[model samples]
Target: MKLTIFDCDGVLVNSEEIYLAAELEFLESIGAGFERKAYMQSFMGLSPGMWEAKLQTCVEAKTGAPLPRDFYAQIDRISTVRLEADLAEIPFARQGINKIAILRCVASSTPSTRLRWKLQHVGLIDLFDPHIFSGDLVANGKPAPDLFLHAATAMNALPHECVVVEDSVNGVIAGKAAGMRVIGFTAGNHCSADHGESLLRSGADIIVENYDDLAAAIERFARPH
Candidate 1:
């Protein structure tokens, strides 16, 4: 059976912007000099723990005080509030999901607790299999292939038979490294000004702008070679 793995944040829940905004606000509140453009460039697709450490270092350097352990807690609180206030639906996600016949799962850099809550809030929790593989579950996260490999194994599918839908360069790299066909989703504005070329260079076989295109790409991928 063919397996399809989805990246959770930008691809499913429109949480990328929410996350960036919350991070910036939190960093600024803690007296960290946050430049949105720079921060996005560096941390857009990094695992939560990596981002947290990077943010802490930045804050420490700027404020001359080590970032509090609760800094991430504050950011999570802000993220939760913002998500509740402006929960966004990925364009055509429901319809596209209904069209797919492949076994599906989520492979995300988000922690399981936050990932489940986001999916639940967006009414998409039931659409995927119970096994949602988070980066924290693996020794190394995205760009390491561990999460995608783990998801493929859980779905009982060979890596070559899996198609990964991702919105970030790191995720595309991970999918490719895991031996899956990677499709980059550009609709969420996850990439920089180059649109999806960065993702393409990172190893995405195809880059789509919307769920319609995403569905079409999957259908094509499932076709006999």
Candidate 2:
């Protein structure tokens, strides 16, 4: 069966900037130098562990303090508040989701619990069947094929028959590595023209800036090849 795998954060919900802003604020509150652009570019599609490792280095260089185990906990708390307040519905996302003729699911780098809460908050929990797949479920996250492959396996769909909708370079890389076609979503400011081009370089078959365009892309995919 053909399947559509969606990335959660920036695609269905407009929470990427909220999360990033929370991270930046948390780091600055703890006296770590936080550069928004640098942080986004470096950690956009990385797993929590990888993010913590990078944050540790930044903390060491800026505050000269060794990374604290509770750092992520604090960041999580801060992000939770910000997300609850700012999580936005992507325009036409629910409409596009409702129009899908194939099975669909979310595959994200965000933890499953958090992803579920966000999806529920935005009224999209029912759009997916059998729940969502998080990077935490696999040994390797985005930029590796594990997460996407896992999702495809869960749906019993072959990689080539599954199309990934993603917003980050790492996600596109993971989708391609998993032998799936990828569509880059550029609704968020984090993904620019250059970023879209990079996603194409990383193996995205198409790029779109809004759900209407995304829906059209999906329809095109449904057509006989």
RMSD of each: 2.3, 2.3
- lDDT per residue for candidate 2 within 1-225, as digits (tens), equals 399999998898988878877777777777876666566666777777777777788789888778677878888888888888888777788987887788898999988888888899988888884659998999988888999999999989999899999888788888889998889888775555576776777788998888767767877887886
- Per-residue alpha-carbon lDDT of model 1 for 135-214, expressed as tens digits? 88998877789999999888899999999998887788888989999998887754456758777878899988888766
lDDT of prediction 2: 0.82
Candidate 2 segments whose C-alpha is farther than 4 A from its true place:
29-35, 61-65, 189-193, 222-225
Clash-forming residue pairs, model 1: none
> C-alpha displacement of 116 in model 1, angstroms?
1.3
Q: Model 2: which ten-residue window has the lowest total lDDT?
A: 33-42
